[model samples]
Target chain A: MIKIETCLTPEILSLHQLEGKIAVVTDVLRATSCMVAGLNAGVNSVIPVIKVEEALEYQKKGFITAGERGGVKVEEFTIGNSPFEHMQEEYHGKDICMTTTNGTVAITEAKKTAKEVIIGALLNVGTVAEYLKEQNQDIVIICAGWKGNPSLEDTLFAGALIHRLQDQAELTDDASFMALAQYQQANGKVADVIQNYASHAKRLSGLKAKSDLSFCAQEDYCSILPILNGEAITIKKN
Target chain B: MIKIETCLTPEILSLHQLEGKIAVVTDVLRATSCMVAGLNAGVNSVIPVIKVEEALEYQKKGFITAGERGGVKVEEFTIGNSPFEHMQEEYHGKDICMTTTNGTVAITEAKKTAKEVIIGALLNVGTVAEYLKEQNQDIVIICAGWKGNPSLEDTLFAGALIHRLQDQAELTDDASFMALAQYQQANGKVADVIQNYASHAKRLSGLKAKSDLSFCAQEDYCSILPILNGEAITIKKN
Candidate 1:
């Protein structure tokens, strides 16, 4: 019997039973999307660091530093959190160290006990779901919400994943059902739904990151499955 | 400049900015509904206590003790958490001390800094919304989710309230908008939607508390507005 659950934010990660479960971490607005883009573009392993200083240290070791604090590029880092930034040919074949306000923190925390931690986002949700279905483990979808509050984009992405996997998985909690309902409510217009409704998308719009928002909202545009290998997130080459 | 926000659960209560705000607490499964029902039935006051011992002490001081843990009436208590129990004639004109698994704890926490705190549920949502509009203060709808996780019924109730209040109030965050969308999706079938979809409702059904679930799901069945007066929750006589 495989049960599926969702932890809406990182704050409630500790409450969910995670031992031996597969944790799919999503920060759809940027972090996980950026990871998917980077890994899909042929980057080497992407190290998810928690602090800006750690990313800077990785820069010193010849790895590209990429992160954001309040939706803007961190100072002295080579790349911003925008998925579009990782699509360049120069970024291909390079090692990238990434950090963000929510996504990396969630991944770091989920790595504590999850037997396997896989990065998920709108761009690669289908790939991630298929891989998880094959793994046949109890899955916990951890949404990296803004700060400590739930984010609509992450929840929507979780719903999209659940919609893909519901046939084989039991919806174990209300949050899962709620997310799937929201996803079904806005099916086929996910980008428009999220762009018009998500708080993070609105915030980025205020910062004039419309292109980044559109880039992140594209569904199934990438096929890379970034899985946590020890301390680094690298693409699973099938 | 009146902003409306929502705290989905007590776990994320700290992340929301609640100072100088009128906090509306909703525990629709039975706590807030029970409070609304008791106050409507003419109870002088309903004191919300966090611990069972506090309710027991209140019972010793000539107040009716009411609460539930694990959705059952606490041993020797005057009543369990069913709103139906509070609608009886004997509960009229009396002071009641209440505690519960999620609702009372959220109310106790909201009392710490909210300029004013009000209890809300599907039973009194219309009245609560009208009063909030009249107050013209920033509002935060705090949902008393099961333990630390977000519950479907509470979120749906929050959405119902948001649907009523969105015309005049600013939907301040992503959560507020998400909730309103949900309410709109389940517009006329709020009860059916919750009963069929809410995890708590299913749990209670498994416990054969379908009657309690139905009682809690009725919209606008009561007219009382439960507001925090100092430390006790009493009816607003407007």
Candidate 2:
């Protein structure tokens, strides 16, 4: 049986042997959600850079830079890390160079070891599961948790993705079991549950980003599967 | 208000600011549970060393040595990592020099940075909560996860500990929130839940340590709060 595992945060990503696994990376509060929304909206590709300076450098090369630090948009960037920004008509057909507090770091780190890295969020959770089924590889869902700490929403997303697998993969790790348990407890009201329970959700609410929370929480908002191809996250054409 | 945080596994323990926090380290399958049971049954103090070689050195100093690796006893030690062995008549009033795969590493690492390090397990969870309440300091419950990976039983113990704190301490991190959710879902059947769900419990069951699961799952089995004072874990006298 193919195995399903979870890295609750990027800090523990190194502990997982990612060489033979397809990593489904999620930052449900925004980053990966932005990628899915952008790709679905006709953006050519989303380039993820670890440093804000790297994204700025990409801006100098004509790519529209989008970035955030601690949920607020970087002052020098063309846009912030939000799905709405990614879905805007002006950004359609344009390429984005992006960086964020947690998501970009997780993406770059995962690229180092995972056989293939794909962006995952509630927005495209179903598509991610479908892609993984086609790949038929052992899977590890990597959650870009809040600053190396586990976050509720990302874990909840992991559970949702695993739930989609539904006995096709064996959950060999406790983190997978824990995620599934959280998803089960959420009882399909993940958005309300996260808004009320996640520390990061409260952080975003305080920053007036409640709308982003709901948008990111929407299941199958897009069928786009954003897989990291070279340095750019482009749609995975099934 | 005091804060409650959780390191779901020791691998992410460094991400936490442990300087002023009371670190409650738990390895519920055996190690910490053994300490709580042993101390409660009258072992003088438990000295946690990080290596089997160090445990052997302590045996040379006439201390009773107990250790395990991958759920089995280390051959050179006087006893293995079960609560029953620690409660034996010969071990009463004797100091134990112990080391295990994950628990000892967590205990030693926690001691380096945390202002205070205390052993926590289902066996003495209530006492741990009481001690933390009296101390009135921020608490970081560190789960000694299996081989630096998160484990179900340890996370459940973390939730159980946080549940006991229950509004007394602010649940500041997502890990703490996740733990509380798991504990609530377990719904007072933690022993059965763990035996049914925890991977570590299954491993122990394969080793014929099923009784240890039920024994360790017993809440408040002892009021002993074994705390690190230098390298030795002595009972904290209220």
Candidate 3:
């Protein structure tokens, strides 16, 4: 059976809970969504780092780097953490290095436990679902809630995943049933998710992250699987 | 206008946010629930402190002090954070000094920002609702999310308060919509909240808080509002 666990915050999750599962890392606001967009636009591989300084260090090595602080893309980086930035022809078959506040921390943390960590967002939910269905071990859909708390969007994404995976998986109460109901009630309205979820609204109201939000919400925009391979995220080679 | 904000976690809520709102301290798993239960059962007042040692110190004043560590009540103390414990007629109409892990920290934090702090949970939704709706300024509904990030239950409670006060106020992107979604989805499922939203769930589950879980789900179990007066949570005079 596919076993599922949900963590309200990233800080409290254990490697033991993640051990050997095909972990799916989601930070739907922009990080994971941006990564997927870049890959789909033809970037060769994306490297995710936890710190701004770390991503900056790679810039000299010819890696196009992206950095974010407090949701807005840092202006000094190779790109801001916007999915729109990734959807460019120049990015095709290129190497992109990224650093984000919450997404990268969660990705790094999940790497320590799971044998494999897969990135998911609405952009690639079906792909993740299909990928997990083929995998034999249990699956953990990790919601990288903002600042380690349950942000509305992250939980909604998890709820969406759970909704799809219900028949084939067992869910933990650590995942809120209410989250699933809300996402369902919205009828998977991508627009509503953008407007109603916490971080998305914050981004919209504060940062003019409309394109990023719209791009981030684009369901199944890419089927390219970005898997964690020791300290970085890379698209799986078929 | 009435307002409610979800703190989302027991940690990381800048105690600074408590600056000017009506703080509603909620810990449905037990803390605030037990405090409310204690009030209904006749405890004169609850002196909330951040540390257990402080709770112990109050015992010297000839007060019936209560303490809890993970979730269960402490030994030697007259009560753990439990509503059932609060039902004791012997404890009614007498002062009870109290300390618990997350809830107390939350109360202490909000005390700094709020004009007045009140205890809230699903158990006292309507009364809290009526109280908030009458307010004209921004009211902050603080949920002591487990250990400093948004928990499922707290956000839902915040959402319930927001839903109740929707017509009377506006919510920041940080909480209202996000929290509203979570509450709508969870719909007062106690088991789901503990398992999904709370960071300290496994520990609480280990402590057998499952029963506490059900008991805490009852809406407005008591109408006695535990209003924070100066440094104490006392029955709201209505």
Candidate 4:
């Protein structure tokens, strides 16, 4: 397996290395978690845009805008960058033009290398892993950190994914080995293990995100694989 | 004060975003630590170069070439990337052209933004911190990680430096907070804290770089400040 790894610090995620392979975009704190929740709640599609201007342009093309900055929803957008917002009745069958500080940027970057893209969060870690195993292809998981730097939390999620992919794929990258070793040392207690990630703790501290952390922390919360083909996120459902 | 905070992923050290500050290149591994030792042992100047070829070129220009790859001295270079190699009597008063995988790249990047460039490692952390504290200028600490990704060790060092300077400046970035928290949590217990840094440990195992780690981990080993001027590193004397 050709597994290459890159830490998705928010800025790096703004544009991922789309050189090759299937890209797994992971934003455990809010964005991908929100995407999972949105799809689970029956949203039709998520159109990711990096800039608010692009999101507005998507809205002009008859899409619904959903976003939050510093955890607050943009005034005109339909949703904040929260899974809590995704659990509502209004999103069913709606095309979501989603933008956030990190998640969307990561999606844009992942689109560069990924012929096939999958959204990864702790919420769907199991399904994502199982689906990747079924596909049996070279895969790259890009962790979208809070900003332009690698936050410990994103690396932890990358570690978790690497841990799951062990035995199924050959690891060649140093970061891959490090992630696997870290995940192994944690011994599957991902929640407590990830507490070392200060950004995760900080993002979850004072908002509805505190509870969302548990939601994201739950393993295999959904069996559905939300894959990105062309431009929209849809479930594998098979 | 302008406090630019960067993470220490081995990869990030090479992929730096340095702009407008005095750049402080940090490699908790062996490069900066070795550079500090070399300067302490009375080496007149240390030239930081990215490519081995550049070091060779510098050697042709009447400079001593000192460098290593994967812990062993490169076949063509005169020195290994070790603090001990740097302390050799032959290096005293000699201008040394040095290169390494990650730290040198970061120093190069920081050069673009910093008015002054300095090297910091665990061995010189206290001295660097004290110098920054006294200089009263906006400072940036670029952690040269093992490769290009964040390492717990380097971030811990960044946090340590930030903690020392936290009273002097407001951390205006998430990178600052992340480093601060990491440093606060992992202070003093360096070995246990960085045990999850499997890649680094494995590289050290291959290189038998234990002494380098031990010396790098030493507190206050060097009193001199290795500053980057033009293209070479020079001692900012007491």
DockQ values of all predictions: 0.77, 0.80, 0.27, 0.20
- What C-alpha lDDT do the candidate models reach, one value each? 0.88, 0.89, 0.73, 0.72
Evaluated at residue B143, the lDDT of candidate 3 is: 67
lDDT of 1 by residue, B55-147 (tens): 999999999999999888999799998877887899899999999999999999999999999999999999988898888899999999998
Can you tell me the CAPRI class of model 4?
Answer: incorrect
Tens digits of lDDT, candidate 1, A1-238: 5589999999999899889999999999899998998888878878998999999999999999898997889989998988878767898889899999999999999999999999999999889989988988999999999988899999999899999998889888988988888888785898998888888877875444788788788889877889999989988878
- Over A1-238, each residue of candidate 2 has an lDDT whose tens digit, in order, gives 6799999998878788899889889999889998888889889999999898998899999999998998899999999987888999998899999999999999999999889999999999998888888778999999999998899999999999989896788888889999998998888899888888899878875444888888888887778788899999998775
Share of native interface contacts present in candidate 3? 0.25
* TM-score-superior candidate, 3 or 4: 3
Per-residue C-alpha lDDT of model 4 across residues B76-145, encoded as one tens digit per residue: 8888887888899988999999888878888887787667888887777777888887888776677776
Q: Of all true interface contacts, what fraction is found in model 1?
A: 0.73
The residue ranges of model 3 lying beyond 4 angstroms of the native Cα positions read A8-22, A51-53, A69-76, A112-114, A136-140, A144-150, A176-178, A196-199, A205-211, B50-53, B145-152, B186-215
Q: Per-residue lDDT tens digits of candidate 3, residues A1-238?
A: 6877666557657523677778788988878888887887788888888887878788878999886888777776878877878878888888888888888888888887787899988888887877787885787777777765556677777777777777887655534454566567577585566665565465565454765676677677778888877666677876
lDDT tens digits, residue span B106-185, model 2: 99999998999999999999989888888889988999999888888999999999888886889989999899889888
Residue B58, candidate 3: C-alpha displacement in angstroms = 2.8
Ranking 3 against 4 by DockQ, winner: 3
Top candidate when judged by lDDT against the true structure: 2
TM-score of each: 0.97, 0.96, 0.85, 0.75
Chain A TM-score for candidate 4 is 0.88
Model 3 DockQ vs. reference? 0.27
Show pairs that collide, candidate 1.
none
